[model samples]
Target: MAPRPNVVLVVMDTARACETVHERYDYLSELNRLAQTGTEYTKAVASAPWTLPSHASLFTGTYPSKHGAHAGHKHLDEGIPTLAKAFQDGGYETVAVSNNTWISEEFGFARGFDTLYKTWQYVQADIDLGKIARTKQGTEMIHALATRLAEGNPVINAANAIYGQFFRKRTDDGANRTNKWIREWLANRNDDEPFFCFVNYLEPHLEYRPPKSIAERFLPNDVTYGEAMSVPQDAWGYIAGTVDLTDRQLGILRALYRAELAYLDRCLGELRRHLEAAGEFDDTVFVVTGDHGENIGDHGLMDHQYSLHETLLHVPLVVHGPRFETGQVDDLVQLTDLAPTLLDAADIDAPELRDASQGRSFHPEAEIPPREHAIAEYMAPQPSMDALRERVGTSTDNIERFDRSLRAIRTDDEKLIRGSDGTQEFYELRNDPEEATNLATERSERVDTLETMLDEWLDTFERADTSGEVSMTDATEARLEDLGYLQ
Candidate 1:
């Protein structure tokens, strides 16, 4: 019998399908090359608008409402089984390396992993500190020390003061560190057991600070790197209508966003080379996807929240393995489907997993099942109204508009977004890909049908039991604030 293939799930945080797959950059040749060797779902949609809920859906094979991990509830309920848990139960060595603070152990993301590494805890360029935190236990010990310092441990004040300088200067957001750890793990991991590794690259997320050489290609000839960095990376300001970005500023933001993705593409190529050198590239299953996308001035928004438009919902999904078919698939697949599909690849019979999941596996050998629509949800306002007001130091009438929850349902050609306030926006996606026009009143019958479908689909699952509150360390909270996810 053939050995069970090892699996690696790579989540490119805040990467969109439009910028990466639909209208790919020349520098994204690595991603494009990977897509050619495997099945690339062009119409893949995320389960939520942002990191927490979308990742929850990916892990549990359920929607935000079912998983109970959304803006309203920041923790993944302990009742729901995760993809890593399933793989671990089936005797696979499970590992996770996350750059985003949202995917940390504090949020219940470390449930099934034998090893979990927080990339930020390790010093980026400092050789001595890197050696100290190179191993898993060393990494955790270093993180615990930092957390103690963050919580006002006076005994290590001098050491904390020194380490804080290196911590704040970490600019790459763990792309290099993630790859380095994976390379080391591949070299040392047990060859007898099949492994399941989940890795997240956060370079494409906010505070777009790509390397100068790569940023030069995306920026205008006249715009200097210093000028590009001068633009405010504040999403709340744009949403609240407090800061109006000039056309030039918007262009610079967009350019920087693309440059970040380009730099990540280079890192991804480096990872592939590492895997090849390890001699496990052909036998390993590779799943590359994005949690969600950034707005970067699209629809007058600077961030991913406050909307479920295609820009934030549609993301790239690619699966490559010897058992999978090659070429592009235009099917409307969701990130939720990935869990079941991967479990199937490992030949694990998980009826409980299948029963809990609302998604169907799009395995290559199986015929493409007809999918009526793709659904997305924003269960609650991220950062909250009060938090936004406090963060921005004032409020706007426009801010009240995004205070409500949003649920969206989309077919092949059209989409209907229903807000908690009973307001709805309808768009003809075929002609108006940007979603510039709201045709809810003009197309009443179509909107009604879509709304009905969304309601019926939502009625299928009840909220998961989320009884506990999620608490994070001061250092973790600081990281979230720096990433623009918190005030």
Candidate 2:
């Protein structure tokens, strides 16, 4: 068989389709380029709210329930047919470089890759205590910038760096460097076999640490009236504190966010340039997506790991490269479908892949299925629910509030979230963009309809068999610990 397209999957952490440079920021021109050059899915949703599960869903084309990694720290089941393994079986060389501990080798994320990298150039875990940026303002900006950059919104890059007092961009630990690594990887690689590379950049995850010049640039003057104070370090269940800001502060916060995104965009642009120059662009299948969305202060929320608001659940997914048409797709797609789509696009029979995986391939001009929703779930992976709670409070830790465990499904117009004990919440997206109103008490008929759908969906999802303990590895334990996944 002819060599299939080389696949380079870039999973930005919190990217949104609507915020791409195409939608707004010109500083992030490259992302717009990618979106315009290939197929963009405006309705894509990450299968989960956080990294590990969402990534597992992305890599395996399966949901959290199907893959069974529901907590902060868990590994992918090595037994499952991961995208890398499946592609490798079809004679492709696969590699992954990730900056999040959630995706470290300790878990199954590294299972099928020929090479996997999870540590960031500057992981928060290893921050030099003395050098660490500590002010709430600094942290808030950092969180915002990091989120913007990580989410593939490059417009925020410069703003983040500039706001953080940066006079010039740093290449060593900056977007340019990340792209350089990818360029080097692609340029130096001499494999005759088709190759798949997964490069996960982490500039955009929270506590928003960017380069030195990026964190300290914001202050009270930059904040809006509403955001003049830092949101408490800890707030709602599963919610973390943010650089509290009022409406006036949004400009600074947004500046930081846009700056970070711009930075990453430049980085991605460089990578794309290299890929094109190397004559690899048209021959490769390129993808960009986020694990989930971050809540940057909507509904009084600071960052992600909080409520299942659209700000947290809706994500960006874009497919470029070869064999895909240039157009927009509104069909609802879960992150899990990524694995199969890539394989199918390559026209390679993925033996390790299973129909049970939640992902389905999207071939250009093909009639897609009619699945109307996606599922996201969260739970305590270990006995130390408190450990997870400390970072993002759960009911076990915050009994006065609601339970932390939540399972939700989202459709185009509405969303439904159900707590384990049957406490439910509903929202009308068109009216409640902030998700401030809970309609479960008021919309009985809608709740019933959604509940039935949820039940049937759960049954179908369970049949996928993503349960039980992940085959453990010391690496997984260490990574989980670093990411606060393992206590």
Candidate 3:
């Protein structure tokens, strides 16, 4: 039998299908080119909001519950069969290059891959782009910024510029690292073996900053942005906990996001050139997708971490390769499906044990069935120990019992979000993609249907043994902070 093709799967952090070259970004020339030669999924859903659990499912073809790595900055257990490991068993080399701070060799993310690497450490010093933005004319802008700071004038303008540039540059750097890793790995390839490689980019995630050149490329000519337009809006709901952003702030925040998209596109161009030159572009089975999406004021939320609204659940998933069809797949597909899809792409059978898996692989021409909805789960930020005790209405001794949790079941037209203590959120995604409406009480009939579905799915949910507590070591926390995670 002919050898299976090498598979290259790229997951762009927080990059939604709506903003990619094939979907919403009209000016994405590079993305357009890639799509011409690839299949793009118009609507791809994420298994979870954050990195650890999301990638865990993507690699194992299992849910976070099954793998037990449900929180951010936590290690995935080495016992699971990562996609790379499956490929390795089939005599294929496996490699994973990631820019995610929490997903590193220090954590169990490095298991099974022959080559696993983390990108350059992003630091406070990289905020210089924001500094440059404040200084309109080099020395003069610098002087103005210093004077404002020294005179206690808020230096808000300087901060804005710095913020804008920081996110932009950081995402650009992420794309660059992806290309660097792919090329370096490919150069040392053993011709007889197939390989499964994962390139994780941190673009379009948070601390939104895009490169200067890339930013101007996407800005609206009509608006004049100010220094206040730097940080994206703080999350909604926990109103007091969020940073209220002004209109100017939103504009600059959007520019930073667009700039990151541009950077991802640019890096993709370089990657394409390299692969095509090496005669691997057409022969490889490549997947361009995101683990989850950002909430840029969608449903009044700023970023991910809160709510399973479409803004967070709806991610982009595109599959293009020799056997896959070029048309889009409208079926509701989750990150869990990736593991099986990839295994199928490589002509490898999922382990018999995986038959109990919740996801199924997609065939190139097979018709995908309609799903009732997609699922999203979160371990909401915990309340203080005192608050937990109060909420549990029990003794403070078992503070461990209260782990503020939330889960969602999102359909094409509606969503049902359930929180601890039976709190619920309902939105008709068709009419309100922003999920501004909560129909849990008002639309009781529909809620019942979804609630039943949620229960059934949960019944089947094989909760991973995370024990519902996550605390990274200080060293690991440092890495996560560098990746813009909340420390």
Q: Find the candidate with the highest TM-score and give its number.
A: 1
Q: What are the clash counts of all predictions, listed in order? A: 0, 41, 9
TM-score of each: 0.92, 0.77, 0.81
TM-score computed on alpha carbons, candidate 3: 0.81
Question: Per-residue lDDT for 363 in model 1?
Answer: 78
lDDT of 1 by residue, 1-487 (tens): 9999989899999998889884245579888888878888899999899999999999989999899998778988687888888898999999999888789778889988998887765332211232222222556856745554444443444243345445534558788878989999999988889999999999988889999999999999999999999998888988887788899999999999999999999998998898899888888899899999879888878789999999999998888887777788887899988988888888877677778988778877556584779889899888889889988888778888879999999988899999999999999999999999999999999998998889889788886665344676555566677788763
lDDT of each: 0.83, 0.64, 0.67
lDDT for position 189 in model 1: 88
**Can you tell me which runs of candidate 1 are displaced by over 4 Å?**
22-24, 123-171, 465-469
Give lDDT tens digits, candidate 3, residues 1-487: 7668989888888886556635446667776666666776665788877777788778787776677776532667767677777788878888887767656765577777887765543332221223334225768866755654443234444453455445534435567766866787677677677778788888777765566667776677754433424454333222233246666566667677877877777787788787777778777888888888876665555666645666666787777778876566576778887777777778886484257457766656435565656787775442334443343354532333334677888776778888786788888877876666677789998888888998898898667656644655443454444444443
How high is the lDDT of residue 407 in model 1?
91
Task: Tell how far residue 406 is off in model 2, in angstroms.
Answer: 1.2
